[model samples]
Target: MRAALGLYLELHAHPELSGAETGTAERFAGHLEGDGATVTRGIGGHGVVGVLRNGPGPTLLVRAELDALPITERTGLAYASTVPGTMHACGHDLHLASAAGAFALLAAEPDTWNGTLLVVGQPAEETLEGADAMLADGLYERFGTPDTVLAQHTAPLPAGTLAHGRGPMMAASAALDVVIHGRGGHAGTPQLTVDPVVTAAATVMRLQTVVSRETAPSDQVVLTVGSLRAGSRGNVVPDEAELSITVRAATDQALERAVEAATRIVRAECAASGCPEDPDVTLVSRSPALLPDPAATAAVRAAHEREFGRHRVLDWPGSMATEDFPRFAVGGVRTAYWMVGTTSPRQWRAAHSAARPVPPNHSAEFAPDVRTALPAGIAAMATAVRQLFKETW
Candidate 1:
């Protein structure tokens, strides 16, 4: 536990961005090596795979992310992010530490369970590219396919609790990159310039109607204009405006409709502005909704009931958060994903009494209470794996 906490502090202090996790990969791989795992590096971009085989039985794979968000840290903790513009605000550092601790516990008690344990440190999860990259790089072909794949994420609930979804767990999402073109000219000559900056701002405002007016209220959809960049100086109008959008929906049909509406809005806004050319809308990445296997989920849920009392185990209604984990479910592979509580009891009480929400993932103020969450995550994971080995299916 002490070693795991130390590693957690180190990772939190120095977090790497997606697709640029070389040093992070080295540290994770080195820890796996210390635990006697046969380590493999660079499966995808900076992905690390550790293998521990003890007499052949069922193979179980545990996944933990290795990348951090681009947000700067605002948590005044002593081990807050050292980087000026990067922080592990999403609790991936905690995820990695818990995974490492679980492996260590299992490795020390080899006689208690028998099988192959594959601890995966997957990179680039934030950009929704790591899982696909690993699959394209022959992840399953090189490493033996496991009978069950397990992963857990952190949430703002009280620590020492776990949540499992009965059916759907996460949303299907897509990323769209748009570039709006216009005629650039001096700010004084407003009549001569098309002013893409104005068009971009107008389009952003108009896009809100896609959800509030266009889509059904019952059908969940989230469209966020995450990035928008235009002119360099206030005195000049830029030639082009770029916007990056992310759309997430409960179903594939809803997702398609939302994307189409967004595209239509952008093109119409450009046409109305009389820009030089049609706007460019490119699909960056798309991932289907994450629906965990029913039987596998049940097995893990039961394991959680045993590890942490039934009162601590709750049913997750579902979330709109997007993940690329469904990409690994190709070819009929059984996978289970759950949520672990990261908030301390005091934090929960304060939020409830104040009628305010706790800081969420990707927030600069978000930080997991390691003293309580770390041990629970480790036990929940190790016990889940041990239970899966004992299940019939």
Candidate 2:
């Protein structure tokens, strides 16, 4: 726990953005190396892997994301992010520290278990490209393939609580970059210009129907227009307006339908406004839905329950959030990814009672109670890894 806290403070103070986590990867690799594990650095764009061989047994891989979000730190903690536009708002710092602590603990107690512990510090998780990049660079071939893979993410639930999902853990997601084109003119000559700003606004409003009307009510889908940019000055009408939309769904079919509908709507809306060209819709990033192996999830959950009492462990429902962690299981390897609570009990109670919104994972104000969460996260991960070694070790 002491080790984890120190590492967490250091990581939180200097967060790095996705795809540029060279120093973060170095720090993680150094932490693992200090624990006597053989470390490998720069496996597919700053990905670090630490392998600890104890004896002849099953190989287990534990992964932690090393990249931080682009949001600036709003929390006034002493260890707040020094980088202006980078913050560990999604708790990757906690994840990295906990994974390192787990590695350190397992490495120290060599007799407690016997197997190969593969600790992975994955980069670019925020953009859903890290796991794919690692795989493309031959992560499994370079290091031995694992029999079981495990990972954990931070949640807004109260600290000291652990949550697990039996099947679908997180939704599949896709990002869309849509550029709506129009004729540029002065604001006074509205009759001569094909206004893309108006069309973009219309598209945003109509996108709600894609989820509410087009999709089945029983099925889940989310279409969010995160950014819409147009002219800077009020007097000048821009020639083009750009929008960035994110779509998430429980299944691939739903995701496809949502994107199709979104694109069709954007094109139709622009054409209806007498635009000259068709809208340019680009799929920026795509990630598959995360479905933890049911049996593996059960075993990990049971281990967590045994380690951190059943009262502290809870069953969690599927979330709209997506992850690339499941990509590690592409070759039929079993995978289990769970969530650890980061909220304090007091804050949880206040949010529920006062109807105040709790700061979620990606929020700039998300300040986790590391004092309680760090130890719990480390213990939970360690227990899960140990459980996977039971049959072999």
Candidate 3:
């Protein structure tokens, strides 16, 4: 556990942003090979797959994300981020370390399970494009698709608790970028300009209605305008304004309706405000929602109860967070996404600041209490892998 913590901290100190995780992938590959697993590098940009086969019955794949956020570091720790503009604000460092630790434990005790293990270091999860790239590059066909897929994400729950949900563990996420165009002029002579800033603001307010009035109350839809940019000066009216949005929904139908409603609102608002021709609403990227398999959840729950006792495993609500791991479900494989808690009371208090907002996963100040979280994560993944292989084949 100390060795795992040391490795995790080292990864936390030297963080890499999405799509630029060359060094991180190489280091993980080295560790995997050191543990007697056959390591494959450069699968999907910077993905590393470690194979450990022992007279396989069914192949079990365990995945861990390996990219950090683009926020500047402010943690002020001794092993702080060396990179200026990137940090492991999302606990991917712990995810990588825990997966490696689980691989180590399983490699040492291969006789405990009777199948192959594929521990994968996936990249570009922050951008939600890595898994697609891996699959396109033959992740499944090249290395024999697994019978079941297992992955875990750390959360803000208690230090040593494991949380699991049966179905719809995470919502699907789509990045919506709306560009509102209009004529520009001086702020004082507002009659001459169309003022896209006002139109953009109105559109932002109207977007809120998509989830509230458009979707059903139980649909679980989230439409957030994360960023809005328009004017550069107080006196001058900008020609165009842009809004970056994140749309989430529990089901695909709800997601489609949200997108359609948002597009209609943007068009209607631009026309009603008498702006230029029309507003451009485009989807930047998208990831499908993760729906957990009942059998997989039951297997994980039983395994958690056996390994950490029934008291440690707890029922959890579905998270609004998005994951691309659901793509694996397309080929008829069961998936389980677990939440490992990383927050402490001190950390929670620090997170309440309005100025800093307690540094969530994408913030540079976001850091996990690895010493308490890594072991449980490792144990959970290992137990899931063992149980999944044993029950299926």
RMSD of each: 1.5, 1.5, 2.4
- Let me know the TM-score candidate 2 reaches against the reference structure: 0.96
128 Cα displacement, candidate 3 (Å): 0.9
TM-score of each: 0.96, 0.96, 0.94
TM-score of 1: 0.96
Angstrom error of the Cα, residue 325, model 3: value is: 1.3
Candidate 2 Cα lDDT to native? 0.91
Off by over 4 Å in 2: 391-393
Q: Encode model 2's per-residue lDDT on 236-347: one tens digit a residue.
A: 9999999999999998789999999999999999988999999999999898788888888888888888898999999889899988888898777989889999998877
For each candidate, the alpha-carbon lDDT, in order, equals 0.91, 0.91, 0.86
lDDT tens digits, residue span 139-184, model 1 = 8888988888889999987888999999789999999999999999
- Model 3: C-alpha RMSD to truth? 2.4
